[model samples]
Target: MAMQLPTCTGIRIRSMSDAHVIFHAVTLGILPIVSRRLDIEERRYIHSGCVCVWEERSAAGEGSSVTGIERWTDGRRWGPSRVRDEFLYYQEKLPEFEADEELSALIFGSRLIKQTYSVFVDTPTGRRKWHLGTSVRLRARARFYLTLICMAS
Candidate 1:
């Protein structure tokens, strides 16, 4: 049986084997964006039960990029070292993107845009509805932050 623990955005710790612990992380937003931001090619493949992401000019073409994740069910043991390395690599490289407002908004909700908007002037009922939508978004954001904080400690 494997045990898993959520660490942070896109990162987790899992025990898939008695001999090794696996660190798994899924890139946030779009893989192409992640590849560009991290200066990697936007392609993914599974090798020895571990997924690898990088640009392969030969396989694709010069100046061309492919973006996607691949999964397999061959039942090979997940290479813990490779998984851990990927987790650490992303952990080091992703902080800036994670903090970016545009990127965060892509994953989270937009802060500036109201959840609900009126086409014309706001009537009292329209205003109330807008406020309700805003409040719901605020609550969700608060909950997300709270969860992050709790996970950190």
Candidate 2:
């Protein structure tokens, strides 16, 4: 089930079906970044297949997954320094905008807030708890984003 990854030059992932390979690639490329954070440049890299996820086996035969941008569209290898430079470049290029506190809260809130509300329950106490948890999460998230924004500024 080994196949050559077109995006990762001279590298092949062993014992992976086509579906697994594609799943890994897509997950690696998209899951880490929120959809709202994805810009045109990120979309271009994703659609052009510049991302790769490969499995590496340790000496003890335990396998681990490695995900990264192995190469650029122009076939240049993305070493650690290259990746860091690209990240810094994008960070600098981000346009300044008024940060929406509520939106930032929703984005950064814990999944526990959603799970607590998702349970099928009609008790007033349960509803109250859920609302309380949601508010706390949102407030914490707002504070976190504010700190980051302040540091960046």
Candidate 3:
């Protein structure tokens, strides 16, 4: 059975504990793509975001929709560079993934694994949402940290 991590209910970047979960995950190299955005130090300051494991599917069963695992991000203060850097880093990481046929096939051959990020900014009219990046992790290493945090609350 696939292990299920605790879900994030209304999590945001303002929460220190929630942000730490992402930092810790990146520090451990749990999500190679996400980790590429940081220069070791920046990872420490990424204190506003929630991580979610999502499964994409198609209702028609035609295999036309995205499938497999995905990491979704909803954060505050994440900049364009952060997401852009990660996308570029994936290019370098692609070669290494060749060893894993399943992962390589899904990522290179098919578009199963994907990522979507959104940033929230505070404004006079409350929080404004900035939708960013439609694109496309780990063997639950990151999930473990998130699970702990979820269970605590």
Candidate 4:
């Protein structure tokens, strides 16, 4: 049988007191997310769109969804000139999305640093909501975080 973590529940990472194990698991998932996003940062040619894949752990939860915001061709070099133009292009469409009935957003930014300069927003309709990190990540994180909290309980 598989070894389970020792928590209140039957099987969960949180129950495991061993920091190394939990760290390994979380990192395994989060690292690729960071690396993949970093690659986009360098190219600066994001294929803007929405991904409608999210996991709902419970009945009452915000539901975390992964959405695409920006795309970069180069994997290691990008400057303000390119990123700025893209930022403006995406921000212009936010009001249009918010106006619709099937609308809500989840913002994403660089997981390495707490900067909100660029973001990836996830909408209910599976549209990629794009914006600056400080600009949108704050709002999106709140929704994702809340959903996570509810699911955990």
**Cα lDDT tens digits for candidate 3, 18-85:** 44464345335463223112234433333222244223222344344434233333222222333332
Q: Please, what is the whole-model Cα lDDT of each candidate in the order they appear?
A: 0.24, 0.28, 0.35, 0.28
User: Model 2: per-residue lDDT, tens digit, 2-118?
Assistant: 323323322222222432444444345641212122234533333211223322112332223222122223212222221221121111112234659986545435211110011
Give the per-residue lDDT of model 1 (tens digit) for 21-51: 1111222323211121111121122111222
lDDT by residue (tens digit), candidate 4, 69-105: 2342222222223233222212312222333333343
Clashes of each: 1, 0, 3, 17
**Clashing residue pairs in candidate 3, if any?**
13-48, 114-136, 115-136
Off by over 4 Å in 4: 1-136
Off by over 4 Å in 1: 1-10, 13-33, 37-55, 59-153
After superposition, the stretches of candidate 3 with alpha carbons farther than 4 Å from their true spots are 1-39, 44-93, 97-114, 119-122, 125-127, 131-138, 141-153
Rank all candidate structures by their lDDT, best first, as comma-separated numbers.
3, 4, 2, 1
Tell me each candidate's TM-score.
0.15, 0.18, 0.20, 0.17
How much does candidate 4 score in TM-score? 0.17
Candidate 4 lDDT for residue 14: 18
